[model samples]
Target: MRLYIDPGTGSMLFTILIGLVGAGIYSARMLIVKLRFILSGGKKVDMNANRIPFVVFADHKRYWNIFEPVLREFDKRGVDVVYMTASPDDPGLQNPYPHIRGEFIGEGNRAFAKLNFLKAGIVLSTTPGLDVYQWKRSKEVQCYVHILHAASEATLYRMFGIDYYDSILLSGEYQATDVRNLEKLRNLPAKDLVEVGIPYMDEMKVRFEKAGPAPKHETTVLLAPSWGPEAIFSKYGDQILKVLLETGYHIIVRPHPQSYTAEKDMIETIMKKYPESDRIEWNRDNDNFEVLRRSDILISDFSGVIFEFAMVYDKPVIYTAANIDTSVYDAWWLDTPLWTTGILPRIGHELNGLNLPMLHSIIDECLNDTRYAKGRDEARSEAWEHMGEGAVRTVDYLMKKYRELNPAERPDKEA
Candidate 1:
């Protein structure tokens, strides 16, 4: 007799087994620690090795961009900020800052959530699900503020994980609406939702304004796609490139950081097939904003970068109809009509099939056509209410939260 197993089934089983074992180990460790405490005099664990007024936590270095502008604000205000991470190799820990202190809090879900003594007056982060799931110690900080990294729709954002945050900083009206709706749906308390635009994009706008005219390049098309089974690369990776190359347009294919590993085999195969040429470049660099800055237009599938491109430069974007695999992730996002709620439809021309002529026509329309121009501008304005001065707003909000937490510490008003 032979046993048959689907690859997906095997993978799921492996993940479940690992998760169970890890949970068991963590429970046992916590139990032992508690027992030791009861056996002896009630002694406190010193997880708060370096407690600071402002503590910022990140899951990995990739999220460092979210904290960059905040850190700069902290520096300017002469406020010392403590940076903590669960990633052992986060390079942000190495970046020297006079007002910022860094610490690598080890790795794994247990280490990430076992942080009980790491106390702070005001904690701020873009990372979701902080100290809520991996461990039961959720109230490790006084005030927790969540900053929005992506300006996507409601259900697409983290569900219960976001609820744990005391305050949420939103970039646009869409996010604020989502939070309000989620609160009503879940019967949860109204969170302190502030409409502070994304900090990085605010900086991007300033940089773009200060910099002279972008260097002229032959009409360049950037193919930057999100990582998944239904990504542009998985659907028609090489075919898209082939068509673009034939059209005499410069092509830059920038894969998501995870895509290089998640779909390594296919990505490598495509790169090998089409070696680097003057007309094509495979971008491995994680910094895609520069790539977006250089490209004439963007070709993407359901990536948040679409909002960044359209809202910032007012450039045109060509998007593939999102091909989401419900089995892999959230089903609710698919259950609801995301396109109807979000500004995606208004900003870009959505392409369904891989028809070359249709694709070419859409690209042309994006470049020169004025049919959707007004709609795009209107959507951009509505979505990014605080378009340019997001960092300032964020800094102001953080300071207010800090003051609220430590009323006595705030300076007294003079007569």
Candidate 2:
């Protein structure tokens, strides 16, 4: 104390002391993790296994509809695939295929996700931005494949995230052209973008075929909007529901799942205000096929459901123009300069969300008018031209890429 050290010197000394302590703690924690890994035989099984692991990563249970059929194809072909999900409580892991291994990595736990990825030889997913930025496992897997869950264009995803994928499976020509344009614009390496149709829709079409057509009714309209700031549910949910309900047409309100996350209170209030009648109902079921099959016409706002409804059910849709202010998204909208082009007069009749009178008019027109019927057919054909039998092709592509990567350990023949 009598030495009278200067304030600057004392501050520097304190900073150094804190840094040393932090580094010491980090080193100790890492040492413990390494020891635990060894003790738990993680490396032993992962590194020395005779069969290479094929993994499908799912971020949510909603995607089970897409991955289940593809996983079934693998099972049928005698391929042993592992299903890894971020949700620990995901129901998909409960009754997994006999040959398929299911693992649930802790949700939002990057360390566990990386550990799971380290064990996978080939990884496939429809979930975008898997470990692209933080705690990346890009180098862990031999090949990472991106499958389009929606028919939207490539710009909907971050360019850097798409770049992280080794291959992409497109649903239609729009996605293919968009990916190529992105590749040229960003000067990034060309990714293997194959038009594999909609893999999820393949299964739905089979079910629909088996179920046959739904019975016609007096104007059944499903109001299925997407999630986000521009979502019709947030802006005109009350007005739209009120107007449609008053019209006495059977209405099914199937808001996007993410809508609950963004506006839970608002949705709850809507439900309480408008008690459900046989004529009106709020649906939260994970499966939308039944809703789409039953509904005669759909009224939505810039949602992928527009394409799914139009292409799958072969019906007309009334779309609300997206007056989206992307600025609120923290520069996220900058990635997709062409996002609006994906939806528009391309598939549905466009209308302003706030215009109640016009919205009602368009609903009537969509129900009765045959002029847009031809346009719907054209759009459906162009969007899902490869609808049927694409799941088989997707499995074929996965195996092909797997063989290319592991030439030495390739399967002698396809199962």
Candidate 3:
């Protein structure tokens, strides 16, 4: 007698509702613009005439690390950038940057409403799915630039995520190749793809260097998984943790930030099942560098953190076999295997149903093995080119495109 809606249906309905609200807001704003033009005695009005030159939109505070270095570069060069975020308490809002003006633009549909009617010369963002979901292209905005927040494949995003962007700043050349291939497959115009290494990773590297070496402690295993139906925790439940706990090694469980929100029930159930104790710990720090530095081994499932731990900390990773539904993502369009999955064997060992029981032995093997060192070096080169100069390169590309869009405002020296 009870009607139930599946997650897919619920998500579709929610997206539709947000789209309707955004369309209504857009219509209202357009009406106001028309009225203003009419009141000016039939004179044409340029909506973007008073638009800001550069804008950076951060949908969540988690991406502040990625945008911080770029904004710092803008601040250093004395270039003005509007930092708009949906999170009211975003750290970016409190950054001590003179040239970067930060503002909290509300969350969800409200944020979409403001962005849908945005007026700007150039807008750079780490958030994708622009023009495909609630966030639509603004007529007044000249260009939309997307920067990679992770050192993974660009095609890993949801279907049509980067397809609508004017330019894409990549972490590696291989990602650019994937983008170009996708464009060709979709018959879309080529977007400007600049290989600008991982900016946050660069920041992490600096922080790690300054922190010196981590003090000696018990061998720790960090379980950091992505969130969603295909995530390790979602698919395998507490089975993975059960096996790890039996290993008698100290364990640090750091669920993806979204897990606390999107998969609340699942997370709560798991946490209740295994309460924190001396041997087990839960980590939800805003900055993961300290925790990552302290840990020796990482266990993850398709999360970008695998690359972070392996490349940044030079640690071993034990990846789980989670068959992600690529049909719902841009990966479906590609014939080649994912670079993340392909590189896993080289950087870490696989943990699946068969190996679940041998987790402890596998952990011992990974700790004792140093064979993946070469693969990690190769991955770093292939996935993160121009390592130490990410922020500078990112700002250079954004400024170049800005100058191209606004020739009259071109400065003598690029930022």
User: TM-score: which candidate is best?
Assistant: 3
Estimate, for each residue in 200-241, the C-alpha lDDT of model 1 and write its tens digit: 877767777776446987888888888786778877767777
For residues 1-415, what per-residue lDDT tens digits would candidate 2 score against the true structure?
4788797676456445544554565467557767878888775333324435588888777787778878888877878887878877777788468766777866754433343325457888876654443324433367788887776665566535576677998877766776776677667788888877777887777888888788867778888888777777677768788788777789998888877877888888888888788989888886677888889888888787787777777788888777655443312434645534543575567766446756667778776777677776666566675768677888889988887777657542353
Model 1 earns a TM-score of 0.81
Query: Can you write out model 3's per-residue Cα lDDT over 1-415, one digit (the tens) per residue?
Result: 9999997786577668766766787688789889989999989886656788889999998889889999999888989889999999999999999989999999986898788878898899989899887787887789999998898889888999999999999887778888888999999999988888989999888888899779989999999999987788977899988998998999999999889999999999999999899989999998788899999999998888899999988888999777778998898998988888788899889988787889999999888887888778888988989999999999888888878887777532333
**Candidate 1 segments whose C-alpha is farther than 4 A from its true place:** 1-51, 135-137, 325-336, 339-341, 411-415
Instruction: Please list all clashing residue pairs in model 3, or write none if there are none.
Output: none
TM-score, cand. 3 vs. native: 0.87
lDDT of 1 at 333: 30
Better of 2 and 3 by lDDT: 3
* RMSD each, Å: 5.8, 7.9, 4.0
lDDT minimum window of 10 residues, candidate 3: 406-415
Candidate 2, residue 11: how far the Cα is off, in Å: 28
Task: List TM-scores for all candidates, in order.
Answer: 0.81, 0.80, 0.87
Candidate 3 lDDT at 21 equals 68
